[model samples]
Target chain A: MTSCSGTVLLSRITAGIPHSAAYDDLPYTRGGAVDRDAVGALVQSAADGDAAAWKALVDGLSPLVWSVVRAHRLSDADAHEVYQTAWFRFAQHLDRIREPHKAGSWLASTARHECLKVIKSTRRLTPTDDPQVLDGISEDRTPEESLIESEEAAAEAERIRRMWQEFEELGDRCRELLRVLMASPPPSYQEVSGALGIAVGSIGPLRQRCLRRLRARLVARGVR
Target chain B: MNDNVGNDSFDEAAQDDALEEALRRAAAILDPVPAELRHLAVEAYALHSLRDLDARLAELTFDSLVDALPVRGADVPRMLTFSTGDLTVDIEVTAEGLTGQVLPPQPARIEILGTAQPTATGTVTADEMGRFLCDLLLTGPFALRLRTDEEVVVTEWLRV
Candidate 1:
């Protein structure tokens, strides 16, 4: 869970990095397992306004949010708005998120809705010079193909869900730390340092420790 | 079927590792939010409390909050059951407080435990899409008494 313990250090370290990277990489997803129990712990903590919990929640679901936005074919500006909107909405519903396992899907749906709204609003405002823009808005996949693709996606999502059940045993800290470490381009040294509150130099060691811990936990649980 | 997977290739560790890689690929399909929007998510969540000030102001705040939620749908399950282990008991439920489509594995059965009076009994089947249909009769506390071909799996009592 993200606490104020790293706030000052995070502020200082993250100050140097350009914010552009946040948009550059895709969202991080835990491929092994999700450790929903740890997620539940963070959710309970976040309900009380724990900053680490907030960060954990964001790290956990950021990819889901991003995926939903992309599915809508929104531009970076529109996608950003939708992403922010999804997190904001997540806060309000945190207390009501009864099922931690479905959190990804929930976040994904919210991001999609926000992106659609943004696109609609943007279309109303921006003058479309390109005929392609108008065509894109009206284009739709064949219903049969859409159904097949939707089913395929749904099955794959279910498989991931099962994987998360195994991942839920690792503690919250490992989940959060490993998630950042696994993030594409490795969430920069400073970002990782600030997010996890480890000293910049200690991040490599901390990451190794976290991975070892997760491996042990997974092995103990008969996961992998 | 189990033998066909191959002893060397289908080891538990190998399956686990393969599943891990699969999850990574699955997550890749999901779109990511831009950095600026992430900052906004932080800001919006921080301001969630401020929405209580006034009704008119609350409306704007509520709109913003609604916008900030990470996912949205007209309707989705409030709870999702990833998997229920083998049934030594009667049956297992995977979700609560939902309408529209429900998904569960096929050939659902309840496992009966040691001489206990079987309170719940039913046939819940998954459709072609792996969705299920059954009325959630138990309100406050519920349990699954399932008897699969292999084992009887009973879920702990839950408050739905």
Candidate 2:
């Protein structure tokens, strides 16, 4: 296996920083490259007033934290509030964290709590008797809308679940290619081609072939 | 009844797009930080640095101590034991989450448990079986609370 060492470059344009530092600075860096120990140290440093370390931590983990906020079904305004508030709370309690490695889960839970609170508050503000409020706030509770959201979320989750099961059905090369496809924002074609040692021209064809295998596997499992 | 059922099915089929749209609307609610908010995070970190590390550390230690005390349960006698000396709490766990709370002899003070990072809390209570159970989202070792109207009782640590 190739070592996942080196900096994750966030963009083609560099501000002239070292590659490792640039990679560490990017949000979408490879998962394996993240060092929890370093993150812990950085957090401690930030607690001690290190501005640069704090900025680096925020830049790197904001995307992951924000993704959790979105998944909680918070309104955009509410989500932003939760995101900002959670960070504030995190800063206040940094030294209290015993297991620094679990910072991700902490951020996730805090965001979820804030989102739920917002949703509940919004629910409470609905006027039960006022005719004007009813007219303004009234949304048709179509049975169809409820069913569709449930079905789609379930179907999407199931599809991803079955895709993993079928991934094991493919040969090693197909697995490797598909893994790259699953990566966030995905690797550039040149990067994927280089990693797999395949001709640049052939990369597209190989991807289609791998996806076909995946589809076939899912079809066999009776998944639409 | 048959005609009504048929009509309902048709309406359901027609409403598929409505559902998709609702889901899209819900998903659109996610709001990430604007580019300018980056500066706020920097400033917050700088302000955090001015506090005394030892003082902050001591507060954390006190927080953990509060978390270590046990609550008594109604049904279970000695069901929820929060003993700082034991360094462990015995509780049953399942896939759904932790299922019990500490019921103390009296309504004792309850504080958040686990490390300061990603910490969570529950009230202290024990069941008739002298059992208090809690389901935590994070699975691992955690600290508990000591609660009494008169004095707080904290445990050393417990694993879930």
| Highest lDDT scorer | 2
The number of residue pairs in model 1 that clash at the backbone is: 50
What is the C-alpha lDDT profile of model 2 across A1-224, one tens digit per residue?
11111112222112232332212423343323334555666666555555665665666455445544444445445555566655655665666667665554455555555555555434432221223212221233332233236667546544433444465346757755554333322334543443344566886667666666666666788864
Q: How far is candidate 2 from the true structure (C-alpha RMSD, Å)?
A: 17.9
How do the residues B1-160 of candidate 2 rate in per-residue lDDT, one tens digit apiece?
A: 1356587655643443233222222221212234444455444453346433322111122221124453343222212333333222334344444443333323434443543332346555554433454454534334445344444444433332
Residue A129, model 2: lDDT of 28
What is the overall TM-score of model 2 with all chains considered together?
Answer: 0.35
How many clashing pairs does model 2 include?
45
